[model samples]
Target: MPLALRDAFIDLEQYERLCAAAGEGERLEYLDGEVVRMMVGGSTAHHALTRRLDGLIADRLAPGGPCAVFRETMRLEAGTARFYPDVFVACGAGVAPDAETRGVPGATVILEVLSPSTERYDRGRKWLRYQSLPDLRHFALVAQDQCRIEAFHRQAAGWHYELLVGPDAVLRLEAVGVELRLGEVYAVLPALAAGADDRPAQAAFTPAQVASIAAMRGLPVSGEIEALLAELEPDACAAAVAALVAGDGVGGWAAILPERLHARLNARPDDASERG
Candidate 1:
């Protein structure tokens, strides 16, 4: 989600005051003289990717770790900008003891899970401002809609860019001496995985993807599904999976129903999405 700007302006000092008085779980950010309130509880894909990346980076580091991975809850200070990145890593004594509402001066690496609304700003001004942090060695933009990672590494000469795509690509974080596989990064997304191919039938529901969907829908994993898949016509099964991967889970289903029936159902929908 994108930040909602308030009708007010503040410097770094006033930003700290607001943060101190802000309620628990409330997150506020400052950039270019604007006070931005972040929208909490982003899409399922965003949270899933963040959780996976956090663990992947943290696990690879030593226990107690030379550098610690911080989630969105941690505040990061970059030159004149004060914002919370989705995932970041800071090394050594940058974190001050007894500092509660404060933040580390900078970070070794910063990452943001790109949302449709904020992708441009994140890759532009935010990325430019982050370059001021002397200790910042890497910055990465994680895509929530697909299996891709765009990274910028600081070199002695300047910055180098790298793009990693597909489930097989690996992201090398030399600053922290860790690597993240795209397969592991997108584990919860049923449509993508390590070594995934364009075989529509085979891609429909791999064992791991089936398990993930089952867990999400709270369905039991009996042998029945395997039997049912075998009994269904191959073309029909393929078409059904294609609908699911098409993005709108409901619209895909509606397209198959008789026009009259679909219209009636849409008028009185009772899906979980409607409840919210």
Candidate 2:
């Protein structure tokens, strides 16, 4: 079934029921009355990065301290919206364990690892919704494929944005008294090959082309594919498609492609060589 049509117009109650009934390995989030499934699984790099960040943040907080760090399974409630940020921290006397609850009511910092499938929503709609949380002070978006992190800090002057690039760059979460080096965040992942230039070149294919490729591969193309691909160079784009055709999946491509597509394509047989 098309993802969009899977669970349309569900309210908070229905969404909660669906989440409760969901099997262990299933992850679902309610967004604008729709239940969106997170990517089936994260890449090794993605998992490693999330773990590293979680550990780093946890280490900074005193044991049984006022703040607690949580992985993706903990949901954050903002109005009627429920979301599972990749990593977040909740602090202060307001924090408490509620057995009947999946919502963290006092989250002060939130982080998300960027994937091709959900980058658009994470950067736009979700970012906006997360800002509505009364206690949210920091939101950081980490790139799984590159040594880049975009940190948004909520200040009395309003929201501030900072782009930290390169492995040596340091990201300071002043709200939580934690600092993360880009290298540490990207540790264990393969180094990103330098493009001819720092800026992403013009995309070699249009949205139609990407959609056609997905259709040919029996994959579903999300709305973010075009923008994600736009960030890659022509060579990287061609290489990614070639990798998919060669049966290596997105693994052989640069990390810029959607992780979900990579996982799906990796499961399929490589027929490009056979057809050739």
Go through the candidates in order and give each one's C-alpha lDDT: 0.67, 0.67
Give the TM-score (vs. native) of candidate 1.
0.67
lDDT by residue for model 2 over 1-276, one digit each (tens)?
204426458788888888889888777877789887786568877788888889988998878768889888777777788788889998887566466756777589999988777776675567667877898998888877667777777776556566677767898888778888877677656464232225543343344444445444544444445445555554455444433433423323233254545554444454432222
Stretches off by above 4 angstroms in model 1 are 96-98, 194-276
Q: Candidate 1 on 82-168: residue-level lDDT in tens?
A: 878889988888755237765777788988998876665675456667877899898888887677787777777556666677888
Model 2 — which ten-residue stretch has the worst lDDT?
A: 247-256
- Runs in model 2 deviating more than 4 A are 5-7, 190-276
Report the Cα lDDT for residue 200, model 1: 33
Return the TM-score for each candidate structure.
Answer: 0.67, 0.67
